[model samples]
Target chain A: MTPQELRLACRDGSFTTNTSGYCAGYVQANLVILPKSWADEFFVFAQQNPKPCPIIGFSKTPGEPVIRVGGKDVDIRSDLPQYRVWRDGELAGEPADVSDVWQDDFVTFLIGCSFSFEEALLADGLEIRNITEQVNVPMFNTNIACEPTERFYGNQVVSMRPFKAADAIRMIQICSRFPNVHGAPVHLGDPSLIGIEDIQKPDYGDAVTVNEGELPVFTACGVTPQAVIKQAKPPVCITHSPGCMLVTDIPNSKLAIF
Target chain B: MTPQELRLACRDGSFTTNTSGYCAGYVQANLVILPKSWADEFFVFAQQNPKPCPIIGFSKTPGEPVIRVGGKDVDIRSDLPQYRVWRDGELAGEPADVSDVWQDDFVTFLIGCSFSFEEALLADGLEIRNITEQVNVPMFNTNIACEPTERFYGNQVVSMRPFKAADAIRMIQICSRFPNVHGAPVHLGDPSLIGIEDIQKPDYGDAVTVNEGELPVFTACGVTPQAVIKQAKPPVCITHSPGCMLVTDIPNSKLAIF
Candidate 1:
């Protein structure tokens, strides 16, 4: 479906599943809405940790309902398939829409997601195990500390995909073109170095098959910001449910720096 | 020294050692000279296997002694520090100068080398183990077969360097910018996957430290053409002695596409 159609379906309560594989050519973003008091610190955190939290679009003005930069007529409150509401870093509710809870002092940010890079990877004839296995990409919290800002501090969270050495090299080259979406891999080979205790056990998301002779390639993941938010414990924070991303009109190719 | 001065020094036998670290920012190329009879097939082989045999410049005419494309006044016979003369695919001699053996039908080719990319990696503060250890980069003959021509056929030869996963990713990025050199790495992680049996014992050059958390990254080596030429058994072939490259006036940065 087109991004507009997907957003419309979402608004009408007709589409409530994960947005993965929908609107294939358009960008799908990780939605993060915060009160104005915490937005500045979160923005600084993203700037300092670009790979995981590459901000593609943000509300130009606080309390504005529509996201003007990332897509035309993109309503921040109801465009996403699902929203996870948080109160003092605790899970409050998983809502289909959050328009009722919208605040005048709230700010919305659209961060780039791995889906775009995965599309590029698949287009290049490389196999992504998560897509093939029909599961979410495996994610782990690493000991690699992030450059922190006031009220925002945590270790990096990385997503893992397994590939043979040569394919991993090609993946690096391909992903390098899409920096906005966690460009290139941060680690590969030994999991111990990154504090990932077991390759088969992921801290978040479902673990996929890591075949023989394949190395687990890890990229800084968007979950990092959520992980940081939990640590920061803001009075209120809202994000898209896992895999339930905000579909945008912007073409995925537009994110490529090359 | 400037490339011109270096060439002059090579011509006069004032500098007779390997040219690995000399003329820091200039492009240093692997030299190959073959008779016009075998040049056509070798040229095709180079084109087919560009990562290993990236041809930066070649003689405009078969009998021309001076190379004008890659650098100025580069006399094919004496511009390199040392030359290896091969007869019927056998090593005939390693000579300081090949001016006396210059054949009218000799066609000279300057193939791109790893030195250019090494300079790039170093400039980015990444350590090159070979440069740090003051030794030649370890090279291995891989089972990864090369696309062959009628007169040339062999497996690829790759040079290995050890880097932590993060540095390896950065190295791939830096190398991708210089495709004229041996672009990005061919294989990384398990050495045996590429048919490299032992990481510690390389087929050519000295092995450097592969630190505890590091993986061995391999790049298609310029030596691949030399290995293929050996198998072809051309009546007469010549190449720059290992590490004794032909320094060019082209600045390394000029090769970066970005």
Candidate 2:
């Protein structure tokens, strides 16, 4: 289905599944909604640490519920497939539609997701092991620290994918064009240097096969802001459930800087 | 001195040392002059294997010693600091001047060198271990086979430079812009994957320090074609002696695609 169609289905509680591989070629974003009090600090944190928290679009007015830049009639509260509600940094509930719980002071942020870059990598004929294996891409928390803003400080979270060196080089060129999607990779080669203790184990998502000759390339992940927000312990926060993203009208190609 | 002045100095027998660092910001090319009978095969080989043999300039016609595109009044026979005369794949002599041995059927080729890309990497503030160690960049004969031509076929020779993964990503971005030189690195991370037995020992040039956290990034070297030419056993061939390149008038920045 198109982004609009998929979003309409999401609004009516007819589509609660993850949004991966849906609305192909269009941008799928991680949704972050918080009170205006915390929005400014989070925005600054994103600006300071762009590799992990590259903001693509945000609602123009608090509680306005529409992200005009990413899609027409994109309802902030109900357009995403699923949302996890947080109360004081604790998982309060998982809701398919948050229209009844919407607040007039809530601000919505749309951050670029890795799905767009993975599409580009696949188009270039490089195999994505997670996609091939039908599992979530493994993610890790790293010793690399994000530039801190008041009430918004945490270690960087990264998503790992293994590739041969040559393909990894090509992937770097492809992903560099899309800085909004975490740009080029932040780390590669030995994972231990970045504090990754086990190659077969990850903090989040499923671990894929890492062949003998392949190197594990890690890119800054959008999950970082969620992790940071959890640590920051805001009064209340809402984010899309993992893999259940907010489908946008924006084309994936539109993200390429060049 | 300018490249023109350096060429003049070379012609007048006033400067005979290696040209690695002399003509900063100008292109220094690997020289290969062969008879017209063997030139077509080499040209095809170069076209087939661009990463290792990116041709920057070549003589317009047989016996045309002047490469007007690369520099003004560039005398192919004597402008370079030194030349190696080869017969039946064996080095016959090292000469400062090849003007007396130049034949009417000789065709000259100017291939891109790593000096241009190394300058780019250093400009981006990445430390080049070889440059820091004050020795030649280490090059190895790899098991990576070159695309074969009728009279030219051999394994590729690669040059190694160590960089931490993040800096290596930046280096790849910087080098991608300079395709006239060896573009982005061909392989990285694993030396044994490409048949490199020892990181400390290289087949040609000096090995630089590979720090504990750094990966040895390998790029296809201009020397691959020379090794292929040697193996092909062309009746008579002449090339620039190692470290003694043909300094050209083209600005190094002119090679950047962007």
Candidate 3:
């Protein structure tokens, strides 16, 4: 379906599943909703740690639900298939629609997700192990610390994909074109060097096979914000449910600077 | 000295030393002069294996001593600081000027050198182990074979520089912009993976320190042509002596596509 159609299905409560393969060429974004009081500090956090938390677009003003930056009819409340409500760093609820808990002082941020660059990679004929294995991309917490703000700060979280050294080089070149979506990989080759203790056991997402002759290439993950927000322990925060992203009208190709 | 001044000094039999540090910011090329009878096959060889034999420019016609493509007054016979005269694939003499050996039916080819990209890496603050250790960049014969023509067939020769994974990634990005100068690294990480049994014992050039956290990044080397020439056993071949290159008027920045 088109991005608009998929988003409309989401708005009417007919599409509660994850929006991964629904809007193929369109941009899918990780969502973060915060109060006006905490939004400025969070913006600073994203600015300082752009590789992990690149902000593609945010609400024009506090309490503004319509994200005209991505699409004309994008409603922050009902456009996403699912959202995780955070209360004091805890998972309070997983709701399909968040209009009931919407606050007048709410600010929504649309973060560039890896899905965009993943599509670019697949289009260039590179195999994504997570897609082939039918699992979420393996993600790990790294010792590489993110630049901290007054309220939000944490170690960087990275998602992994395995490729032979040559293909890994090509992946880096292709992904480098899309700076909005984490840009090039942060690390490859040795995982222990980046403080990832075990390759088979990820802190988040299902582990895929890292076959012999392959290097586990890591890119800064959008989930970093969720991890940071959890550590920061904001009184009220919201984020997209895992794998359930906001389908934007922006085409994935549009994100590539080159 | 400017590239032209250096060329003038070489032409006048004054500059007999290597051109490594001379003519900064300008292109330095590996010189290959072949008999007209052998030039066509070698051209095909270079076309099929650009990574190792990227032809920056060539004589306009057989017997042409001037290369107008890179500079206004580049005389192929004496523009380089030194030339290696090869008789039946064996080095006959290393001469400051090749005016005595200039042949009417000779075709001069200027192949891209790694020095262009090495300068780029240094400017970007990436440490080149060879430059820091004051030795030649280590080179290895890889199992990675070049696409061959009838007369020219051999495995690729790669120059190595050790860098931490992060620096290696940056090096890849920077080198990619200058495709004429070997482009991005051909392989990184394990040396044995590419059939090099000993990382410390390179087939050509000097081995530098590979620090604990650094990966030995490999780029296709211009030395591959010299190796191919040795194997092909051309009746009469000429090349730039090791570390001596043809300094051209082309600015290094002009080679960057982006």
Best DockQ among the predictions, by candidate number: 1
Worst 10 residues of 1 chain A by lDDT: A68-77
Which CAPRI level is candidate 2?
high
Q: What are the per-residue Cα lDDT tens digits for candidate 2 across A1-258?
A: 899999999999899998998989999999899999999889889999999999998876888888888788888788888999999999999999888888998999999999999999999999999999999999999999999998999899999999999999998999989999999999999999899999789999999999999999999999899999999999999999998999999999999988
- List TM-score per model, in order: 0.98, 0.97, 0.98
Give the per-residue lDDT digits (tens) of candidate 2, residues B37-95. Answer: 99988999999999999999888799998889878998888898889999999999999
Cα lDDT computed for each candidate against the true fold: 0.92, 0.92, 0.91
Model 1: per-residue Cα lDDT at residue B22:
90
Judging by DockQ, tell me the better candidate of 1 and 3: 1
Task: Predict model 2's lDDT versus the native.
Answer: 0.92
> Using DockQ as the measure, what is the rank order of every candidate, best first?
1, 2, 3
lDDT of 3 at B95: 84
For each candidate, the DockQ is 0.91, 0.82, 0.75
Q: Can you tell me the CAPRI class of model 1?
A: high
Model 2 deviation from native, Cα RMSD in Å: 1.3
lDDT of 1 by residue, A1-258 (tens): 788888989899999998888988889999999999999889999999999999999997999989988677888898888999999999999999999989999999999999999999999999999989988889999999999997899899999999988899999999999999999999998999999999889999999999989999999999999999988899899999998999999999999999
**Candidate 2 residue pairs in backbone clash:** none
Better of 2 and 3 by lDDT: 2
What TM-score does the predicted chain A of each candidate obtain versus native chain A?
A: 0.98, 0.99, 0.98
